[model samples]
Target: MSDFSGIWIPLITPFADGAVDHAALRALVRRYADAGVAGLVALGTTGEPATLDAAEQDAVLATILDAAQADANAADAADATDAQRRPLPVLVGVSGNHTASMLARIEQLNSLPIAGVLIAAPYYTRPAQAGIVAHFSALADASAHPVVLYDIPQRTGVRLELDTLLTLAAHPRIQAIKDCAGSLDTTLALIRDGRLQVLAGNDLEVFSTVCAGGSGAIAASAHWRPERFVALYRALTEGKLDEGRRIFHALVPQIQLAFAEPNPAPMKALLAATGWVRNELRLPMTRASAALTERLAALGETLPR
Candidate 1:
């Protein structure tokens, strides 16, 4: 099983002139690596991978992996010692509604230097608990790399129940879970179960989840407040709850605003306002409104670095 135990950013997709901006994407990847994120999750919900076509998804994944590999090489050269260098893992999110399609994508991605797959529970259709387990079990068995189950029921109508998750955890390939179950009960259950490593998919619950014995988080808010999130994880791991809470409270406003609208849109707008990425989303996912843009901009300015 893959030990996915750290703070990973579900990176934002960059666009220029209604296309995947490769240059901007490479720059962003390098920037995040420099910022000290534990890893990079490409084509995640924050990356708007669903909006992109199949060819676009392949292009984005190849570009991200290449860039990350190049950055690791450079850092290794700088250190001049293997002990001082660690290659940052690249996790590709290939989640969708269909199990067969997802399995195919995982097979296609097998050649890449990707560390694992982040599979969200089947979205829409709201499958039964048994269906959810079957879906993930198939993917886990098919995937050559480790599988991290994503349970963001708020977006995906189907929720991977505790019992189903326990069953899935028995599969050696199914390593961890991105627990966005939005409840402390499920989070605690996973921790107490003693097998699946829980990652807080919700930014607000990261500290408490870690306190409850979670591994870490795969937060969208980390796109803007990467350092703060990293600090919270560090503090919690260091047994400094007071210090973690102080930073967590200060970041609540930004986190709330980032998710105010549909994903990436709010995060894209905030990044654009700060000159990170262009505030452009594909059809169906529009940019944040003027009022929200202003609010996010103001909040970005006050966020603790």
Candidate 2:
């Protein structure tokens, strides 16, 4: 099983002229892989996957996988076998209200080289806990890769209750969770129980979660100062609380700014300033305000590179 621990970047899908920019996407994959993130989560909420058509999504995943493999090859010995080379793991996000569609999607992913799928509870329908359990159970059974349960109630409109979470954790394939449920008690409980590896989904909570013995994070904010985020996780896991706290404190300002506006806007704005990607988003989502962008740029300069 792939270890879903350490810091993972839920990538932002870069767009140019209102279309997916393969060049920018591949650049991001190489940058993060070099910076040492634990893995990458393509098409996560941060990636603006909903705006992308099916073909574009497939291309984006292919680009990420190809770029990561290329990076692995470049770093390893010439004679290194595939098993000896560490290809960066990438998790593709799959979420929806329909079970059969999700199952079919997972079935399709069975042939891909991705690490796993990140799934959330059914949205819009607001299924009851029983239904949520049934939904995830069926998906887990169908998935050839390990499952990372995404529990962001704000988006899903329903909480994965403690019982529901514990129930789902019993499944062999449901190995971890992206915990944005905003429940520290539940986070602690899962960490203590040791059934599922708990990865903090909210960027701000990464420190506390890792400190509390949770795994790491699937942080959107980490896209900015990814090395710092990785360092913070390393410090906390290695019993260096003071060092971890320092790194987290430095990153809090950026994290706050990243989410100051809804999602990838502030992040894209910053990346644009740095020429990493164009600051563009699809309809219903726009770029961050100029003021916020400037602030992110200035603060980004102050952060350790």
Candidate 2: stretches off by over 4 Å: 76-85
Candidate with maximal TM-score? 2
Local distance difference test, each candidate: 0.84, 0.90
| Deviation in Å, model 1, residue 84 alpha carbon | 8.7
Worst 10 residues of 2 by lDDT: 75-84
Write candidate 1's Cα lDDT for 1-305 as tens digits: 45688789898889998999898888877777766777889899889887899999889988888888777677546553331155668888987788888888888987777889999888888999988888888888888899888988888987888889899999998888898888788889889997888999888888788888899989888888687778888898999989988988888888888889889889888888888789899988899999999998887687643
Report the poorest 10 consecutive residues by lDDT, candidate 1.
Answer: 76-85
